[model samples]
Target: MARVQFENIYKRFGKVEVVHDVSFDIKDKEFMVLVGPSGCGKSTCLRMVAGLEEPSEGQIYIGDRMVNGVDPKDRDIAMVFQNYALYPHMTVFDNMAFGLKLRHFPKAQIQKRVEEAAATLGLENLLKRKPKELSGGQRQRVALGRAIVREAQVFLMDEPLSNLDAKLRVETRANIIKLHQSIQTTTIYVTHDQVEAMTMGDRIAVLNGGVIQQLGTPQELYDRPSNMFVAGFIGTPGMNFFPGAKVVAEGDTTKIVLDGMGQVEVPADYAKIARDAAGKELTFGIRPSHLEDAALVGEDSQRSSIDGTVDVVENLGNELQVYLTAGGKNIIATLDSRSRVVAGNKVKLYVENDRMHLFDTATGEAFF
Candidate 1:
C-alpha cells in the first residue's frame, strides 16, 4: 500500500478547465472517496491518479514517486470500473489471472494469486463460471478479484456498485468494506452517491464545480459542514434552508424571525454569534432529523416550536419523513414512524436550536 498526494493539480480541456488546483493527501492504507454530482471532475481526478489522464499542471505522487509522466501500467495501481469490465467468454479464474499472465508471471504464481483473490472475494465456487453465467454481484466480485490479484500499490474504484440492485448494492458495499479491512490496500474511490461515500471512505473530499468543497470524516461533514453547499449536500434528506431570515437580540434572549412563519427563542449563548447580524438577511438551516413532532417532545425540552401545514408524509419502516411549509418555506422533518401525521394536517414541530446552522445569505458561508 502507498499514500497518494495531489499537489495543486489542474486539468484543462482546450480552453475549458475541468479541475482547478485540486489538492489532497491519501494516507497509506487509507480509503479516500472523491464524491460529487455528475460533471464535478471527480472521475477526472481519479483518472489523473491512475495515470490514465495527465494533469495539465501540477504533480501527482504515488508513494514518494512522481507519476505525472508515467504510463498507467507503470503506476502500480489497479482500477475497477463501474461496468465490471469482465471478459464475456473467459472463466472467473482466467479473468483474474489475465493481468498476471500478461505481465509474464510464472504459471504457478499466476494460479496461486488468482486462487487467493477468488478466496478473498468469496468467488472460489464460481471460478469456472463465465461472466454471463454469474450474477451482477458475482461479476463485480470477479472484477474486484482481478484487481486484488494485481497486488498493486493502490486500488481505484469508480462507482463499482452502481449496476447492482439496491439490495445487492448494500451487500456489495459491506463486502467491499470487509475486503478493504482485510487487505488494507490504499484505495481512492469515486462516486456520485453520497451514501456510498459516507459509508465507504475513511475521509471524503466533496467536490463541485471542479473544486474541493470540503474534506473530512463522515460525521464531521454531516455535523459541522463548512458552508451551505456542504450542509445541503452531505445529508440524506438534505437540510432545510430558509432564506431571508433575521436575528434580533431580545434582552437576555434572541429571536430568530422567519417572515410569515414565526420567531424561535434562543438563549444568549446560542445567539451571541448573530448579535451583530440583526436585520441582515441570513440563511437558516436545520436538518430533518433534528425536527420532531411537538407532542413527542418533553415539556421541558429546550427546543423551540413552529407550526406548519403538513404537505406530505412518507413512512419508512422505522421513521416518518414529513414535509411541510413553515414561514412560507418548504421544510422536511423526520419523526417517529409511529407518528400519525398526514397530509393537510396542521402540526407543531420542535426544533433543536443548538443543532441549527446559520449561513451568510450572499456568500453561503456558515456563521457557526
Candidate 2:
C-alpha cells in the first residue's frame, strides 16, 4: 500500500533519549510533514525510516515491510535532502540519470525517465545546464527530478526549500504541491518552518523536545490544538499567552479573571466547564487575528473587550500587527489597517469570544 508506519519508536544517542516512543502512520499517497524546531529529533526520525539510523526500540515499516535491518538502497524509497547535492560538473540531465546509471538501467529507459521527470518539474528546457549555471530554484527542481526518476514507493524530503530565497520558496512550494498531486506518491516531508508545514502538508506531526506534541490536519491543529505547545507553535507570531488566569463563578455567570484586566464573562455553553475549572491557575490563549480594535467592533455585548497600552504597531499594507500590554501581559493583535491605533497610546481590543483557548498552567494541556 506504500504506507509508512512507526510503532513505539525510540532513538537514543549515547544513553540520552532523543525520540521517545514516537508512533504515527502516513497513509498511502499522503503528504505528511514532520515539523519542529532544530534538535527536536525530527531528522533523526526521518533517518530511521530511510535506514540511515537504526531505532533504539520498536519498529519502522515502509509499505508493509519492516525495514529496520535493510540497507538504504534496498528500502525502495527516494530522498531529497536540504542541500541540492547536485554535482557541479554534471548537467541536470546527467544528475537526474545518475541513480539509474548506478543500477545499470538501459540507456533508452534512463533517458525516458529523466525526460519525464524533467517535464514534470519544468526543467526540460534546463536539462543541459550545469548546477553552477542554474538558479537555486532550478537546482532544487533538478534534485526533485532525481528523486522523481526513481519512482520509489515513498519520497522523503528534508527541508528541501530552506536554501531558496523567500519568493522562490513560495513559487517552489506551489510546484511541489502540484507535483505531489500529479504523482500521487506518498511523501514524508520534514521542516522547521511551521508555515511550510501548514500549507504543504495533508497532515502534520508537530515534534518538540524529541517528542511529538500533536498530529492532525492543518485546520485541526490550528482550531483545536491538543496543548499549549501546539497552540503556540503552529501559528505565526505564535499564540498570545496570559498566564496565571483564573476561572470563577459569579452568581449566574462564569468569568475568566485576568489579573489586571477585568473579568471576561463566559458564554452560556462554556459556563459549566468554566465553573468546574474555577480556582485553578490556568493559561488563556488567543491568536493575534482573534483580537481586533474595539472601536471597530462598536458595542457588541456578545464579544468581550480588554484595554491595553500599545507598545508597537507594524503596518503590513493590508493589516496592522499591534503589540500591546494589558494586565501586565504582552499581547499581539492583528487589526484592520484602517484602525488608528498607534504606539504609546491606550487601546481597547475586542476579543472573539469563541476563539479563546484555555490551557492548564502546570501541564500545558488545553482545557478547551
Candidate 3:
C-alpha cells in the first residue's frame, strides 16, 4: 500500500530552477528508476522524495498521506546512498542493528530482524566482520541489509552499484533484482547508467536539464522514443543521425536524399509522411544494429543500401563494430564478425528500411 506520487513538482535554488514540473506515480511493489546525466536533477528529485529537500512547488504523497514537510525519519522509507555509510568500527550485525537500537527496540526483536535481513542478503557468514574487512560488493550488501531490517514501506537507492567493479556491478545488479522480487517493496532507484536502468527498472523516467523527457517502460522508450534526445540517449552506441536530409518523390517512390551520399527509398508505411515532408530538412536516424554488410544480404533483398569507406573495424568475437564515413558523416554499423569487411575497404551497407527514424531538424521531435 506504499505507492509514491509526485504531482507537478519543481525545485529552484536562488535564480536557478533544477527540477521542472515533474509528475509520476510509483505503484506499490514497483521498481522505478530515475535516470539521467549528472546535474540533470535526478538526485535532487530523490532528495525531495526522501524529505532531505523540499520542492519549490507541488505536492508529494507517500501512500495516503501528503508528506511535504515530513522529516526523513518519519517518511516510512529507507534510503541506501552511493557511499555504504557504514560505521567502520562496527561489525556487520551491529551496523544492521544500529537503526533499530537507536529507536530503542527490544533486544530480542532487533536480533531477529537483523538476522533475517542478513540471511536475506546472504551475509550470515560475515556477521562478525567489520565494514573495512568486507569487499565492495559485500559492503554494498551490508548497506542493503541495514535498510532491509527496517522493513520500511519504501526503498530509495541512489547509484548503489556504481562503486562496484564491472563484474561486481553485474553480480550486485542481479542480487538487487532478486532482492526486489523477494520483498516486493515500493522502490525508486537513481543511476546515470542506462544499462542499469534497462536491467533493473520496471519503468524508467528519463530526465535532462531538470526536465523529465519521457516516462515509460524500458521497451517503450527504446522502440518508440518520443523525441531525438530519448532516442539518442537510450541505446548503447545510440541511434545515428543524418542531419539536413530531405525527402522527395521520384516517380512513384519517395526517397530520403542525403547530400553527397545517396537516397533511400522510403518504406510504404512511411511514404505518405515522407511525401508530406518533401523538400524540407529532416534528421534521419537508424541504429547501428539495423545496418549490415550488403554482401551478406541476399541479392534480391529489398533493403535500401548505401556505400561507405570503412575507417575502423573492431572484431568483438560475436559481432563486428565497423566505423565508416558516409555522405560526409561518420556512421557506425554492428555487423556479423565473419564478414570480410575491414578498415580502408569500401563496402555497401544495407539499411533496414522499416527501422529508420525521422525527426524535425529544428525541434528534434520524432516523426515515427
- Per-model TM-score, in order, reads 0.96, 0.97, 0.96
Candidate 2, position 345, lDDT: 95
lDDT string, candidate 1, 202-280, tens digits: 9999999999999999999998998898899998899998898888776777877777765566655667788776656
* Candidate order by decreasing TM-score: 2, 3, 1
Q: Where in model 1 is the C-alpha error above 4 Å?
A: 266-270, 300-303
lDDT of 3 by residue, 172-197 (tens): 99999999999999999999999999
How accurate locally, in lDDT, is each candidate? 0.90, 0.91, 0.91
Of the two candidates 1 and 2, the one with more favorable TM-score, higher being better, is: 2
Overall local distance difference test of candidate 2: 0.91
What does the lDDT read for residue 325 in candidate 3?
Answer: 96
Q: Candidate 3: misplaced stretches above 4 Å?
A: 250-252, 299-303
Give residue 266's error in model 3 in angstroms.
2.6
Which 10 successive residues of model 1 have the least lDDT summed?
Answer: 298-307
| Tens digits of lDDT, candidate 2, 75-146 | 999999997689989999999999999999999999999999999999989988999999889889999999
RMSD of 3: 1.5
